[model samples]
Target: MKNYLIALLAVVTFGLASCGGGDDKAADNQEATQAVEQKADEAQQQTQEADNQANDNANQEENQEAANDQAAAGGKDGKTLFMENGCVACHKETEKSVGPSLKEITAKYGEDKAKLIEFMKGNAEAIVDPAQFATMKPNLEITKKMNDADLGALADYIMSIK
Candidate 1:
């Protein structure tokens, strides 16, 4: 009877230990699963951010391309061309700097846009400031290379300054 009781006690103790160990293993597995899930979430968030950034960059590039295409199609106005070609450095709408003012040029041309275009093309002589022809020679060279449409736009802009 004593041996039987001892054996029963040993069996119960082993069973209890096994149950405790199983609980500990279950807890460890739960912690491991949570860690894996958290890492996956972080990776997903990073991927989403990267995708958004790529989309933003693509949008910016598309906008820039559209603007370039518009410019190529002669969408640039005369004022934009004037400023781009450095005309504003020497001339102003009402004030004269190194060159005659737009108002003076317009007054001299007097609704004659063709004559102004000719002068810009270096075909006609300078009538507004003949003595300043030497200073205008370089600018005339630049204008001489412009297309007729651009020259017409520039002339129109000058004529409208009054």
Candidate 2:
């Protein structure tokens, strides 16, 4: 009976020691997994931040290019030039006649003032009314030398006529 009790105690001690190591291994594995997850999360966050910054830079560049184009076209205040250049003779603010109106011009060109100047330069066609432009061939000869800045200003004015 005494030997049996001693053997049982020895086995219990051995089992306890073996169980302790299993808990240590489990804790180590859990810690390793948590660290890997943390590193992955950090990497994902950094990538997301970089993507956002890149997107911001692209947007800013696009806006600057647009501003440069508008500046080249005399920007938003070109109306005074349009009135001085006799453009109003063939065109009205909101109505059409021998020529289409300023409202129609804005609808055709939106705020792209450079395109308006290019059309005046004869580098482009009048998209709004190709037929009406045939009536302006005589005027085009006169307008060819009117200068880009002046023409862009006139276009800007037309865009803002409303």
Candidate 3:
């Protein structure tokens, strides 16, 4: 009877140890699952950030393209810029006011757009009315700062007047 009791107690102890091991395994598995979930969440957040940055870059590129298109449309933008930049205050389409008229300018410069552009840059002599060039010198401060597209547009609008 004594030996039988000892054998039974040993079996019970072994059984309890095995059951506790199973619970430990379950806890380990739960921790592993939580770790994997955290990693997945981090990856998802990174992907979303990358997507947002790409969209912002694409939008900026689109805005730049639209600006380029508008600048290239010289007829509209050029005429508008010309009037807004105070060219209308000195120059006119027909009659000469503070400077030579557009007709006089076109007749003098003719098809030589190079000379016209050069005059704006303050590099060439004024053939339209050399005597009145001193009065126009102050205006070059404004024209010299203009980009080529704007200057071309301004010239186009002026030439179109005739």
Candidate 4:
């Protein structure tokens, strides 16, 4: 009977020790899981911040483009006006296209700013490429409405190009 009691006590002690050890292991696992969740949360926050920064950069670019377009409309520079007025579509800086290149126009009319502005205003006839006058005449509708300053700037910009 004494031996039986000793055996039962040994079994109970061993079982209690194992249960305590299991509790420690479960606590360790819980801590590890919490750490993993924290890291994942941080990574998600960083990703969200990066996305917001990218969106802000895009908005800044859009705002800058809008400002540039506005400047091209009434700004002192003629290059902007020329670019915004669709002059680049038909005329290139150096190469000839549907219309005479800006260089060619500059070479022919650079000596006379008044004449160039008058031509842009549609008050003067085509002198460089009269064969394409019909094509150029239609484009003048936009040019004729420009103020004198913009025309002068455009003429100056065309002449300034090499």
* Top model number, lDDT: 1
Ten contiguous residues with the weakest lDDT in model 1: 62-71
Off by over 4 Å in 4: 1-76
C-alpha local distance difference test of each model:
0.86, 0.75, 0.81, 0.84
Q: Which of candidates 1 and 3 is the stronger one according to TM-score?
A: 1
Q: For candidate 4, report its TM-score.
A: 0.53
Pick by TM-score: which candidate is best?
1
> For model 1, which pairs clash?
none
TM-score of each: 0.55, 0.49, 0.53, 0.53
Residue-level lDDT tens digits of model 4 in 1-162? 999999999999999999999999999999999999999999999999999999878965764564465477756567778888888899998899988888899888857979999999999989999988988888899999988777877876777654
For model 3, the stretches where C-alpha displacement exceeds 4 angstroms are 1-76
Candidate 4: lDDT over CA atoms?
A: 0.84
Q: For each predicted model, how many residue pairs clash, with residues at least 3 apart or on different chains?
A: 0, 1, 0, 0
After TM-score superposition, what is the CA distance of residue 94 in candidate 3 from its true location, in Å? 0.9
Q: What lDDT score is found at residue 122 in candidate 3?
A: 79
RMSD of each: 17.7, 11.1, 18.5, 15.6
lDDT of 3 by residue, 25-76 (tens): 9999999999999999999999999999998789657645644676776434
